[model samples]
Structures are given as structure tokens and as C-alpha cells.
Target chain A: MLSCKEVTHLLSEAQDRKLSLTESMQLKLHLMVCKGCTNFSAQMDFLRRACRGYLTRDTPRDDD
Target chain B: MTSDSPSSPRVTPETLAALRTDMLRFATLQLRDPHLAEDMVQDTMLTALNKADQFAGRASVKTWVFTILRNNIIDAIKLRARTVSASAYTAEGESLDAAFDTLFKDNAHWSPATRPVAWGDPEDALQDQQFWTVFEACMAHLPTNTARVFMMREVLELSSREICEDLSISMSNCHVILHRARNALRTCLQGNWFTASGCATC
Candidate 1:
């Protein structure tokens, strides 16, 4: 089983590149059983979406 | 004036100037040099004005202008990379091993206090102004180069290969920096926003 730490690293890496088949399988298996890793994966997705959204969103003016 | 589609948005100097503050902030964050950021934003404004006739309404004015700024920032980063040693771009004072050590156990599981918790339905939070504040704070908390690389990859939408080549880092090093950045930002947001007891404001 992939450890949560390893799973998180792979989760981050998955953003930049495609995971190998064995690595993907291992990640899927671990995520199925690990709620924490599952939540972490979801948050990573949210972060990416939020970053892209940042470009279009209006930031309040800072007069300072 | 040449005949133009009525749907095209008019690009005014005032409109572009209004967006300057945000553009400068974005440039400054990515470049980490106020003067260079100012120069890039100024150049972007000039280019946008010169190309005002080309503006189409398919995207919002903000999006179009930002696209120009993104290109300028990328060029500036590449130029700096060529002029400066690659070591100067390294994430100073940030140790990825130490960061992981704090978040994981000796056995490689998440440490009890650092385990991830559910942050329900973050989509709606994207519309919340307070949420963006927390998000920006989390981004600002990242190590200098990590934030730069993350913005390049996530905001500027640069490929990892382009980033590696621009910063003169190996592919694996770029991955490590990006991974560390995500971890840091995730933990920061969890603590400051989702898990905080008080108001969502950072």
C-alpha cells in the first residue's frame, strides 16, 4: 500500500505530469481506503481551479 | 475609425488604468521585483492600448489584458534566468525534506495533527471575496521561488518543460518545487480558512 505521504507527493506530481500505470493504480487503491488522502486530493484540485480563477476574478483595489 | 463589430468591447485608457493596480500586483508577485513588475505592467498597458482595435468581446477586458501581462511576465522571467545564475532562483531557506518530515510520521503516514480534513464544497468559496483574501494570503506565504514557479505553472499556465528550461532547473527539481508549494499552500489555507474558528478573513 502506498503511504499517505507518498500518496500526497504523487498527488502533487500528478498535476504536472501523467503518472505511470503502476503508480496510478497504487494511488487509486490508497485513495479508496484513505479518507485523509482523498480529502487532500480534492483540495489539490480546488487549489488548481482557484489559481486559474484568480486571473479572471476582480481583486479589490488597494489604494495604498 | 474603421468599421468594427458592435460586440467588440471598447478599450479605453481609463479602463486599462483601472486594471493597472491588479496587474501590478500580479506582476510584482511573480517577478518579486517592484521595478521590473512596474515596467512589465507599463509595457502591457502600452501594448494593450496600441492593440486596442484588436480587442474582441469574446473574453472580458480583464482577461484579455491579463493575457498580455502574462506573456510579458514570462518573457521577463526568461530574460532574468539568462542573466542570473540558476542558483539565485532556488527556493532559499526552504527544505522540502524538513517540510515533509513535519507533515508525516517516521513510518510515512500523515502525522496526527497534520492529517487532511474535508473542506466541503470549495466551489462556492470561489465566489466569496473573503475566500480569495485567504487564498492570496496563503499564496503570499509560500517561499519566494516556490510562489514564482507555482504562479508560472498555475496562473501563467506554463508547461513544466517550459518552466524547467526558463529557470534552468532539472525537470525533477521543478516537480519538487511545485509539489512543495502545493503542500505548503494547502496546509496554509486549511489552517487559515477552512479550519479557522473565527471569520474567514485572513
Candidate 2:
């Protein structure tokens, strides 16, 4: 089983590259039981979406 | 003003000037230096104006101008990489590991105090202007190189291979920096935006 730390690292790597089948299976198994890791995964997805949103909204309001 | 096509707005000084604030904000974030960002934006504007006639309607004028700015930022980053010592590029590696260590225990599990929590719906936060302000602040918190590389990958939409080559770092190194950057940004956001106590106004 991949440790939560390893799982998080793999989660980030999954964004950049494909994981091996074994790695994928391990990650899936870990995520099924790990609510924290699951939340972390969702946050990663949110971060990516936020970045895309940032790109499309070119003209940010001046109040910031 | 009478042109039927809306994709390509006429490249007038006003149109280009309107984009200056956003362009400067992007450049300033990547360069981490206001003066240099100003210069880069100036250069981008000049290049855009000089080649105004070549502005094809394939993409929005903002996109076209940004592409020019992106290229300029890339060149500037590459130039800086050449002049700075190779050691400087890797200075953040240790700190990144230390950051991860703080989040995870010796047994390689998340430290209970730092474990992730549900952030509720992200859409609401995305639509909030205060969320972007917090997001930019989190971005500003990153190490200079980490933020630059993150912007290159996420905002500029460059592939890892291209980033590795352009920054002259190994593929693994590039990945490590990117991972650290994401981790840092998320952690910051979780603290600042998601948690009730983190932001008084929000």
C-alpha cells in the first residue's frame, strides 16, 4: 500500500505524467479509504480549474 | 468599428493599452520585479504595434498580445537562467522537502494537524473576487523560481519537457518544483480561503 505521503506525491505526478498500472492500483486503493487524501485530490483538481479561470479572466478588477 | 468580424479587434493603441494592466500583472507575477515587468510589457506592446498588420483573426487580440508577452517572459527567464549560477536554481529543493516533511510525518502519512479538509463547493469560491485576491496572495507566497515555473506550466500552458529544457533542469527536478508549487498553493489557499478564521473579510 502506498503511504499517504507517497499517495500525495503520486497524485501530483499524475497531473504531469501517466502512472504505472501498479501505481495506479495502489493509489486507487489508498484513496478509497483515505478521506484526507481524497480531499487533497479534489483540491488539486480545484487548483487546476482555478488556474484556468485565472487565464480566461484576463482583466481582473482593480480593487485588489 | 464597422467590421463584421468580432474575433480580431482593430489593433489600436487604445485596445492594446486597455490590456496593459492585466499584462503588467501577469508579467510582474512571473518576473517578480516591477521594473522588469514594465519593460517586458512595454516590449510586448511595441512588438504588437509593430506587427499590428499581421494580427490574424484566428485568436482574440488579448490572446495574440499575451502570446507575445509569454514569449518575452520565456526569453527573459532563459536569459536569467544563463546568468545565475546553477546552484541558485536548486536552492529551493531543500526547503521544499522540509515543507513536505512538516505536512507529513516520519512514517509518511499526513500529519494530523495538517491533514486535508473538505473545502465545500469550489464554484462559489471561484466566482468570488475575494477568492482571486487570496489566490494571488498565495501565489505571491511561493518561492520566486517555484512561482515562475508554476506560471510557465499552468498559466503559460507549457509542457514539462519544454519547461525542463528552457529552465535547464532535469525532468525530475522540474516535476519536483511543480509538485511543491501546487502543494504550497493549495496549502496556502486552504488556510486562507477555505478556513473560516483564515480570512476575516471572507
Off by over 4 Å in 2: A58-64, B1-8, B82-90, B199-202
Report, to 2 decimal places, the DockQ of model 2. 0.74
Per-residue lDDT tens digits of candidate 1, residues B1-202?
Answer: 6667656676778889889889988888888889989989999999998998788767888989988998888988887754444464453525644665677788899888778889988888899889988888778767677778889899899999988888888888888788878887787778777877532221
* Model 1 interface CAPRI class: medium
| Highest TM-score against the true fold, candidate | 1
In angstroms, give how far residue B5 of model 2 lies from its true place: 7.7
For residue B146, give model 1's deviation from the true position in Å. Answer: 1.4
> Across residues A1-64, which tens digit of lDDT does each residue of candidate 2 receive?
8899888889988887899999999999999999899999999888888987885664554655
Error of 2 at A47 (Å): 1.3
Check candidate 2 and list the clashing pairs: none
**Which ten residues in a row are the worst by lDDT in model 2 chain B?**
B193-202
TM-score of each: 0.90, 0.89
